[model samples]
Target: MSVNENLAFDALSDRVRRQILSILGEGGELTVTEIAESVDMVGRSTVSSHLRILRTSGVVNERRDGRRRYYSLDTEGSVRDAFLFLQTILRGGVHFDVEATKSADVAGEIQQDVS
Candidate 1:
């Protein structure tokens, strides 16, 4: 797999990272304090680690404002590419009727009596 794909998947593998992404997805930029408070489990240092991974993964964009750094989603980043990959998987292969599977499942079931 490509570096971008690897980074995207690695960044997505952690619950903390996924939570951080969800918080950033809310819209505007947020500071480390805000992100930590939102996550409410990790410390500032831990959040910083997560932010560093996210930034390195190209999943988030950061900007310096005075003494604080603000973070937001990177629209054209690896995460977006990962999502597009999932979309491709969903659309690939021959089309099939899901209802047909239901009928097949019903036909394969064997009834049994239980006391």
Candidate 2:
């Protein structure tokens, strides 16, 4: 998978993927089994596929424990920076306080709040 531009947001566009990120971000690392249990899907394969896309986007990192694989967020700095850059380009003069919040922690959850 390519970690190209907008990959994180693009990957987040899907509900399941976003839920996966939210679960990982709010809690911490988890395996495909745990993630599958949270979402509508009941199969590990489905969760694994979503995790793969997130990992490719640099939005999640993975760690292995024995036969289990755990994944967590990886967009703490880069994500917030991207949103600030967008605000700068869109808002012009950039009056907003970019330092007010951390991007990694919010990620797709912010959009959920606004919508």
Best by TM-score: 1
Task: Candidate 1: give the clashing pairs.
Answer: none
| Candidate 1 Cα outliers beyond 4 Å, as residue runs | 93-115
Encode model 1's per-residue lDDT on 1-114: one tens digit a residue: 567877898999999999999999984699999999899778889999999999999999999989989999997999888887776776644234466676677666733222
> What is each predicted model's overall lDDT from 0 to 1?
0.86, 0.73
Q: Which segments of model 2 are wrong by more than 4 Å?
A: 1-4, 76-81, 87-115
Error of 1 at 87 (Å): 1.2
TM-score list, all predictions: 0.78, 0.64
Q: Write the per-residue lDDT of candidate 2 for residues 71-105, one digit (tens) a residue.
A: 88876633455555566676743434353345644
TM-score result, candidate 2: 0.64
For candidate 2, the per-residue lDDT at 22 reads 84
Worst 10-residue stretch by lDDT in candidate 1?
A: 106-115
